[model samples]
Target: MIRGIRGATTVTNNDAAEIVNATEELLWEMIRANDVKASDVVSVLISVTDDLTAAFPAQALRRIEGWTYVPVMCMREIPVPGSLPRCIRVMMTAETPKAQEEVVHIYLRNAVQLRPDLSLTRKSEL
Candidate 1:
């Protein structure tokens, strides 16, 4: 069996380093919460707000983790009026023996405002 874990996070600015850092933080949390390993990850799909083209969050993840061979794709998040800016979101599908209810999803930083109850864990598990 397998499950999908969706996580979202936002940066306060468009700086490349900041975007990478924030994205790294969010991704690490998601990976940790679900106990995901390189081999367990089926694929990682990432999207970023229109205002944040400083770098691709997916590339950032690959660079930091040295997951050069992982399947990673990046797209721009639709720009909607009054939407959160400088945001990076991910939909990760992994090969797991657990059900959806057993997988931990993460939503962090200002994105936490989207799901207060599901916003985080003391584990920084996002």
Candidate 2:
């Protein structure tokens, strides 16, 4: 089946370093949680909050082992009032045997508030 793993994290600043590091952390946690292999991943879609214009979240994938060939798309999220700032969100589509309910969604930092129900794990608590 084709499954989607979701992850989101808030960067401490607008710097490219912060964005890349936080995104890498988030993706690592998500991959570990889902027991996902790079070969199983079909594509990755990344979205950043309007306030986060320093870097593309997908750029972090370049540093990740075995993910060089995976396709990635990046976009800017809509800025709604009271929305979280410096937030980066990712949706990874992959072929896996796990069911929807068994899939793990990750949320870290201030982005945890964005999906309390869907986010079963937090990096800070790990």
Candidate 3:
């Protein structure tokens, strides 16, 4: 079986270090929540808001131990008026035994507002 795990997070600014740090954090959380192993991952597609240009979020995935062979790609999210800014979104497809409903989607930081229903944290807490 195969499933897709969605995750998104935001960085406070456009700093390269901040983007890398935030992306890595989000990836780790998603992995932990779903118990996903790098070996099982098929590919990861990442999109970032136009506002974030300091770095490629894929850098974080490349840094993960044992993830060297995983395919990853990054691109800009479609810019819509009043849409969230400085956000990084990821769709990770992997071979897993879990059902679609069993996969946990993660939304963190300011990006939580993008999908309040899937977010574990309340808006007030962000």
Listed per model in order, the count of residue pairs whose N, CA or C atoms clash below 3 Å is 0, 0, 0
Task: Give each model's whole-structure lDDT.
Answer: 0.80, 0.90, 0.91
- What TM-score against the true fold does each predicted structure earn? 0.87, 0.93, 0.93
- After superposing candidate 1 on the true structure, give the runs of residues whose Cα lies further than 4 Å from its correct spot: 64-66, 120-126
| Rank by lDDT (best first) | 3, 2, 1
Task: List the pairs of residues colliding in candidate 2.
Answer: none
Off by over 4 Å in 3: 121-126
**If ranked by TM-score, best first, what sequence of candidates would result?**
3, 2, 1
Question: What RMSD does each model have against the real structure?
Answer: 2.3, 2.1, 2.9
Tens digit per residue, CA lDDT, model 2, 1-126: 999999999988899999999999999989998889999999999999998888888999889999999999999989898888889999999998999988889988888898887754444345
Q: After superposition, how far is residue 98 of candidate 1 from its true place, in Å?
A: 1.7
Show where candidate 2 strays beyond 4 Å.
120-126
- Candidate 2 has an lDDT of 0.90
Clashing pairs in 1: none
Q: How far is candidate 1 from the true structure (C-alpha RMSD, Å)?
A: 2.3
Candidate 3: residue pairs that collide = none
The alpha-carbon lDDT assigned to residue 88 of candidate 1 equals: 88
